[model samples]
Target: MIWPLDGASSDVVFNTWSHFSLSLNLEAASFTRYITPTKVEQKVRHLVIEWIRNEIVRHIPDAEVLVFGSTPVDMYLPSGDIDLVVQSKSLAVEGPPRSNITRIADILRSTDMALGEVRIFASAKIPILKFVSRHGKFSIDISVNVSNGVAAASIIRDFIRDIPGVKPLSLIVKCFLRSRDANEVYRGGLSSYLVVCMVIYFFQTHKGMRKSHTDPSSSLGNLLLEFLQLFGYDFNYLQSGISLRDGGKTFSRSERHWIYRPSQPRLCIEDPQNTQLDAGAGIHDIRRIQMLFIHAYDQLQAEIQRRDRSRSKALLLEGNSLLQIIMGVPLNVSATGPRWIAIDKANARKSSIGSILPCSIPQGDSIDY
Candidate 1:
């Protein structure tokens, strides 16, 4: 819920020079003022968004769009991507929810004549389409999750923003993990790639076992088998120079077992399908990253403890509080009593938003993957 703006508010700036300046400062005593330059970046993005919507409606008309990205709160860094979500009539939402990526790709084939390399996605739930416009490499990668989970995500983001002293801790932890994992390589256990592994490992270790994202006891066998399948690497490609290969179609017994390993450049490649599995690489890759992250994670804990001399003793915390806050809010809100109302913008032909980071990679860039 955002507060409304009144024209006659006493808190107003009357500097005529500001009208001619290339940037403006938003001030609030309780918060840091975010400065945005009067530049063409946002204008360009808004135009692209329009082209995207019209292109979608050219095929399918009845769809709702919810954008979660780095734009709204002005976190759109120069390196960020244009992220978006689409619910169009061309997509089938009944079964597994139609492939948003495929539809977007098809649209790109035709729409590229106008926008050039536009990215699109289809979703039965939460479909994300992210693209980079820099260096003329604009592309869209889409994925579908729980469509109904939008509100829950918002609540989670807002909860974190209300709290203080959370942001610095998370950055410290992530940096520590990245450095430690890089240094240890094989023998150590800490890393950026292994973060998910750490969390999943945490969940399982606390319970002494792994469970599917779904029911636990209902399919224990299936879950462990799937988990093992994830870590098993594609041994088909044996470190050759530019030799073409593909990921193993089957999971073998040896892959489930870890041998001595080494850590170097992270072997992890982009998995566009978002199956959220560790694919293509070997146990060596995970172990290497894990080794480093362990050291960083430990350092993060020490730093947090240092700060927590005035902080809490919670055994664990969802330290991703600040980033989560900006990520969660689809629109902004200001407190001004009951007049605040943040309108859910309909996905029109001229308006929509997407995620800020260009993390989603191309679908098929790996030779042996």
Candidate 2:
């Protein structure tokens, strides 16, 4: 478990500025900093990724193991899982042999490998092999082929490096979604991949707005609020779908080759690499999810308004309430002696934190994935 610093000890620069400025600037900075995972967590994930890669190779000499998803993109949360794709060019083309994933799971489960809770989902659409390290520092998902995930990870990493505010803004939106209990797709909510795509699309369309904010952080905060507002109040799920490749421009169902059906998800996000697949397919309740986005928008607006009034007491409550509602308690990692906590099945919200990898894409846009 990672323990974050308490308010008294946190590196917040509030006292130096005027009350209003402090409340607006420092609070925003603190919220972002508090949610961003520490470097140690990143290091542990990297080590776990390497170990999973080696274990897969040790078992299948010809197998190719490639790390993808958030681990590669560097946007993973403290509770995130590592995503690995196992492929042998020959096996990848023909698809998994009936027992392929099982054998790999067995190899990784051997006592020498020091991995635990090895489970193989052979019947899954992608056929995943899931395992947690014996130390419980991290969990990983292994799949066959699925190079598309790797390709998407590469695209995200490049965006982080090339784009000014992509990383922080994406991270902020993701944390917001996670806080609202809307980030897990398997639970019929938004996927982290979809959230990222949404953030990227916003950035693409709102590049002009970046000039309005003085710094990257403020721009990110503003963009995040706008993102929530857009999805919550303005986006028309029934009438349109989001296309990141097309600069986040909306496409009509007919023009984009999307057939509207009652059974399909309310929102349609074209996969960046595979346009045929809908990344937001798991979103079963559009109204409920949009309500969450709106709720967050309301909370953020309240906090900003309190800051404007210079009501420190009210501001603190609203700020903390917003953070608590969104991110659970700020994990006191320093106090939690363990470097990593085992995935708790009881905590349904955080259990699937790192499970979804952003690889699926929607149609349109200038830059081809």
Candidate 3:
């Protein structure tokens, strides 16, 4: 059973949220390394996306370019990468798609936009073109015809439109995940997409705790606290898998027939569009992730207890107390080792970041999103 937030705990959560949101605009900005992508950063992404699309269409006339993910949805951090999908009838060919994508990457390299090395992952499950912009200070990922990502962006956009506070709550949690170095699922953590889905599931199912008349900001404080509690204490990954489309219900692990691997981290979040795809399949260190969630929860509870007693220490910890703990005091900027190093001589590889080719466009491509 879910733990209900009583009146007292509810007050504490609300007050803490107020302080947390305020601090995000104030004190948290001072110590936190990242910020919500500024207007200038967003404009730079638009220009880059246009440049890529035009170059692709020169070869494939029917090609279309779509920008999805957090950027289009208005929930991205300044450091967040722009996700793009290029689709055209020309890409459906006889051999691997990498050859064609590499050609496109070559074209992009010729342009001034390709400040850093442009990489082509031909062997990736979904072939991708990755590069960091010199002027924009943001990274980009271009995939071939990933219509699913476009669909996801549409659904999330609707969710934000209907649900108040969804944007702010998402920003806060994403910042928290970024701070903990747990947002990239490929690195044994969760993705921003999965986190967004989890927040939606919680909002849909917990009507008792949400008053229709109450502003979303007020509800968000308690919702944030409950979110950590849900993942940290209540959820059972071993026995069940989360199915948001099924009204946030749990289905037995046996029903899913997922092969158990002692070596792999297993926390299943059924993709609403595709049941076979475990949205959380990339999570390899779930225990460590849950520990952080629980710690955050306990820290808030302790602070609330202190506040109730009118303690001197509680007064000292006011203003940005919760925000500081959530975002952490000092950013972790360590370069103790090379960015990527191999253990053995045979596996050794050097940085491949600045390679480029000549790809330019006369005009910008039409954008769908």
Query: After superposing candidate 2, which stretches have Cα over 4 Å from the reference?
Result: 1-8, 13-25, 90-98, 112-116, 210-214, 262-265, 310-322, 328-369
Give the per-residue lDDT digits (tens) of candidate 3, residues 1-369: 001111111112223333333322333222222234444445555665666667767767877878888979867765678898877667656345787677668767876667779999888888998997654545888887668988888888887787655676677677677778888877766788888887777776677634575665644556667888988888776767777774567677767876376444367778876888777776767888888889877876666565555644445333324444565542221211111110111111111211221244233333456
Name the top TM-score candidate. 2
Residue 158, model 3: lDDT of: 83
**What TM-score against the true fold does each predicted structure earn?**
0.34, 0.77, 0.76
Candidate 3 runs further than 4 Å off: 1-41, 209-211, 262-265, 311-318, 330-368
By TM-score, highest first, what's the ranking? 2, 3, 1
Using lDDT, rank the candidates from best to worst. Answer: 3, 2, 1
lDDT winner between candidates 1 and 2: 2
Clashes of 2: 16
